[model samples]
Target: MRPFLASCLGAACTAALALPPAPAAARPADPSGPVAGPEASRASDLPGGTQSLPLEHLVPAAPGAPAQDMAAPQGGAVHELAPRTVRPFSLVGIVWDDVAVALRGRVQIRTRGRADGRWSGWQDLQNEKSDDAPDPGAAEGLGSAAHGSTAPLWVGASDAVQVRLTLADPHRAALAVPHGLRLELVDPGPDTPAARTAPATTPEATASSAANAPLAPLGATEIPAADQAAAQADVTAAGGAAPAAPVHIGARPRIVTRAGWGADEKLREARFVYTRNVRAVFVHHSATGNNYTCAETPSVIRGLYRYHVKSSHWRDIGYNFLIDKCGSIYEGRAGGVAKPVLGAHTLGFNNDSTGIALLGSFGKTAPPRAALEALGRLTAWKLGLHGADPRGRTAMTSTGGNLYRKGRVVEQHVISGHRDGFKTECPGTLLYADLPSVRQAAARLQGR
Candidate 1:
């Protein structure tokens, strides 16, 4: 058994090590028209989209105040947009032109619900630094089109929005507000055709599904689960060589492929990147708020996909996988689910890890039990594939981040929270605290 585990791990690492990381800056531009796939239909046909509006200096309410209050006693200024009616949107975030610059300020927003027509209180948007980004100097981090962005907040269906940005103390001038600031309103789009009805098959979807071939039928919305023995056989059938001895692997969990979430194949770069091995799993909360239903999960994912690729200018959606509150796991980035697909998530730790994002903000609210269970099941199967122990620790080299310097080899849990890799309140305090139980669940699932 030990020999098989060693062989399995060695094989996985060898396969991925041969493929060097692709430079993000060199990625081909998104195709302007529908791609060649059956799913390569017009972008307009896609349900969700993002609206970006520049924020202007806000006028002071008090008389004789500095125009736009650029130089207040506090030494900082405020930029905002007064409430105005607009198309329906469910999520919002702030983006700046420079990916290298961080937003050193507070972002608050209020929205008028489309159904009730009532204004909600100002909600603070989490300012995520490079915590949710690719490592500096990495191919995924070198993209010229990438933008600095705040964590997106989900506000449900809203027609009117007002945003305010308050820069921090002026004494620290170097940490001033970032340039080219804009407010992004995202409409997850209608849930009907995008989620309920199947669109015409596209070559992209077929290819993506084929990556999980034999485990699930072609064009399958969700990959069906398999027992441990069946899963081991499936891995071998899917091109993974069998080990010398029997490898300890968990049962494969059901996962919704990218096609199941209606990802427009034309929206992302065509090339996929690879990493050596998935040494750890980083958990995160979408921070897009918790106002969605299970049925709306696909639309919400679609909204995030557009925002990540179009608004934030990434190669694709950052997380490797996303889980809904209902415990349904959805494939995020376009790469094959079982492959060591490098994700633009968890800053310095992205190279040898997989990221699983829970679909709603879990800061104040507790995450649903189903979601935690899904997390455990996911980590059990994925980590088991690479011969990682969910309850164990591994040394991971930090490329660069607030918590560690480049080349720092830090010992981390096999299942870790995003905050563990970077300095940010990600996965939220409540969810972060529940990681102990998740590790235990995953370890048990792996028969450890």
Candidate 2:
């Protein structure tokens, strides 16, 4: 039998580490002029903010002409904006007032690069309503703020944009566009000097630092790895109770804390939610595109956070953790990294699972070897914490989704792709194809 380590209270574990506090002013607040409203104030406090503009209907094309023939759409009920300049932004998405309504059509966008001053070809924004979301009726899923949205696309640094939305079947009266449609342009903000040079000392940063404990010093950017024996001993030292059955646990791997990437604590809802245990790990790719340098990763992550909370009205960021193309892992959400924090990631399956999103679109491009290795190490350690076998399968109850109905228990891989639980192409095709190897590697890391 695989040896198992006991679990402990997050506070107790953190106290046991007892590291020194970090510098108080590691990340200074934004210096931009103040804005209006609670939401706008929150945005101004962060390094970057979002710009929302309503989409307008365009006149129909000439009779019997193809929709593609005109500069814009040539047919029925099209909503779009002609090319226009806007403030600097690195990410973009479309959102509507109602969460229940789905966009039954194609959504495309083109942008002018901020640096090069060149316009890029139009790209499709995946309709993410059916896949990426909190479970139905959950607190995050309910409310005036929660809205239907397209998958966010990372457009790099762009100063101008154009958007087009069209129904799949223009002639069908039943297929109409959703109401309150608007475009959200998100600027992740520039990497601040303090964030890049100093250690974080905020309460949230301290909590995150404490979660990693002895594996990483307080305010350290990355947690260092430990051997299996040392890792188990560290858990025991942290007062983890002994488990009844033997459980296999893997060596802990290095992980970047939220503070490491400079997350503004004031942005997300203060309260943290917990689950019973983590039974599975759902993998995803931030459909945000791959046009980024490793140095720009922190800004990209910050942009995603703002988009999720400020734009989509989620209580917090969706994924439990985010991995960069270079394989550096950043803690996602606000709860302790080791705890079973409920995240608004995979629809219908957020109950007993953890979500890990890779930081770029992967439909055609393959994830780097370092990223895949990091995935293996992270899964092995995290799943091992809960006695879950990385290569084994687990049955998770679905709340409600395109693939499974509410209350249905579905058996799935302990490590699964986003598409496995929903009817959408997430984590992309190429990355999805690599899960088997990742599973195998994780299992080996556990000494199984």
**Clashing residue pair totals per candidate (backbone < 3 A):** 6, 3
Question: Which residue pairs in candidate 1 collide?
Answer: 24-139, 37-203, 38-202, 38-203, 39-202, 154-288
Worst 10 residues of 2 by lDDT: 1-10
Candidate 2 local lDDT, 249-305, one digit each (tens): 778877777777877766677667888888999999988888888888888888888
Instruction: Report the C-alpha displacement of residue 210, candidate 2, in angstroms.
Output: 3.8
Candidate 2 versus truth, CA RMSD in Å, comes to 14.8
Instruction: Give each model a TM-score.
Output: 0.83, 0.82
> What lDDT score is found at residue 100 in candidate 2?
78
**Model 1 bad stretches (over 4 Å):** 1-46, 61-79, 141-143, 170-175, 194-200, 237-239
- Per-residue lDDT tens digits for candidate 1, residues 122-224, read 7888887765886676564225657899888878888777665665542332344556777888886666654533442766566666766666777777888
C-alpha lDDT of all candidate models, in order: 0.74, 0.74
lDDT for model 2, on a 0 to 1 scale? 0.74
How many clashing pairs in candidate 2? 3
